[model samples]
Target: MTLSIDNLQQMEIEYIKMFSEVSEDEQTLTFNNSNIPDMYTHNFDLYKSDVGLLEYIESQINKVETKAKGFFRIETYHPISADLIEKLSVKPQICTYDFMGIETRNYINLIGNPECSVLSAESSRVLEDGITVDIAVNEEGMGLDFATRRIKGKAEVYKNPDKAIELFVCYSGDTPIGNIEYIPFNRVAKFEDFDILEDYQRRSFGTSVLKHLLEKAFDNNIEHAYLITDQADTAKEMYKKNGFEKVGEKTELLFLF
Candidate 1:
């Protein structure tokens, strides 16, 4: 019992249709039943016609969710039919959509760019939820320490106070209005190099921090840089300005977590 390419294609379409009804999110479409493997593929004509990929995706998600043994995944070009994308009921596990990229050579060029030069412009080195911040870095050379620890996977346990990093912003004060922490990545691709407090968003701060991070990666001899964000958001456009193009789409990998 073997399936031809055409048979597989048809099965793919059929599976897509079935998943759409149950999942309501076409992005979760996957061939594997136990888990949605993270696969990155792209089609430029996804939005050439009215109700083209969106319709197909919706139909497929419905089919998969109805028979979900685990999870589902899908990726497409930006500007997916907003109305259709809203219908998806899939619980977004981890969204790695808005990815930015720059040539290894241009790493230095981006350093002086206005987007990365502003004094007020800061990096999202830490992310927080009101009182409890998941991460932090200090002015007395603590951020680099935490970053090194995080990348080395030794700072996983933050229960010890010394393990934290003390981060700062443009504003000058004894206590920061908002705290920043060092969120280091194993690979220097995705999440804008770091995360910051939710309060200090939309000021174009992350752009600057990312530039600094790029410089650091370059110093470390990294040739290429990248990051990912929600596929259907303004972040995609933001990355475009930063010189990142869609290389491919990665389907959800259920068992990784």
Candidate 2:
């Protein structure tokens, strides 16, 4: 099939929907928990006028009062006016992600590396000598709070029994330094949460893990291989080197109280 903008947008929608534990609609997604700072997800493309944006922003504030309690966030596919920030009385949090999909031509053939081996193991699978593959949510222990990193908290997915996610952790010499997630939806294998420890980076471990996943993609008959990354220079560079490009982008806004 063709990799269209619509396809990329849908992937992002589904990715965020996985966290909708309270309510979800065409325009907004509200998480029920207050401790989770990113309790609201603004999914509409309604940046036509300042009035429309203000109305939408107010609704989100009202929803926060009705839904979750703690600090909240609004993520939009369209850009809003700076005036909206003053009206809503919320701080502006800017973030960008490159929706990258692997092209057909780039998949010349399935290749594996000798250093980093891929294993279909559990997240807790320990490595005695080398890094073993495992799974987990790629969140920093500080929860979803955007202001401070001092509070070490985890996402609810870690404790939710309904969550169906498999985290891939790569270890190098008995140390867990690299990680990724395999989200298979609609017969498409989406690789996300790709990260490597700072000390272990630039050592070909990331490339090897990516290639290992690609090698598995061949046998799975996956319709697509893709991932979304933030503005991390090192990770972005690695993805571009391995044949990934920015297909689309979305705007994310965070509010703290």
Candidate that would win on lDDT: 2
Give candidate 1 regions above 4 Å deviation. Answer: 1-99, 111-131, 134-194, 253-257
- Once fitted onto the true fold, the runs of candidate 2 whose alpha carbons sit more than 4 angstroms away are 17-19, 32-51, 62-68, 81-88, 104-113, 126-164
- lDDT of prediction 1: 0.37
Strongest candidate by TM-score: 2
lDDT of each: 0.37, 0.55
Question: In model 1, how large is the Cα lDDT of residue 39?
Answer: 21
| Candidate 2 structure lDDT | 0.55
Give the clash count for model 1.
38
Pairs of colliding residues, candidate 2: 131-171, 134-169, 135-167, 136-167, 141-153
Question: What are the per-residue Cα lDDT tens digits for candidate 1 across 1-257?
Answer: 22222322233343233212223243332333212122212100112223465455445446654335233344433344446555655433434443344544455554322432212213323212211232333223335544343423322222234432223232212223332223222223222224434554455555555566556556766555555456776546655765656544333311111
Q: Which stretch of 10 consecutive residues in model 2 shows the poorest summed lDDT?
A: 127-136
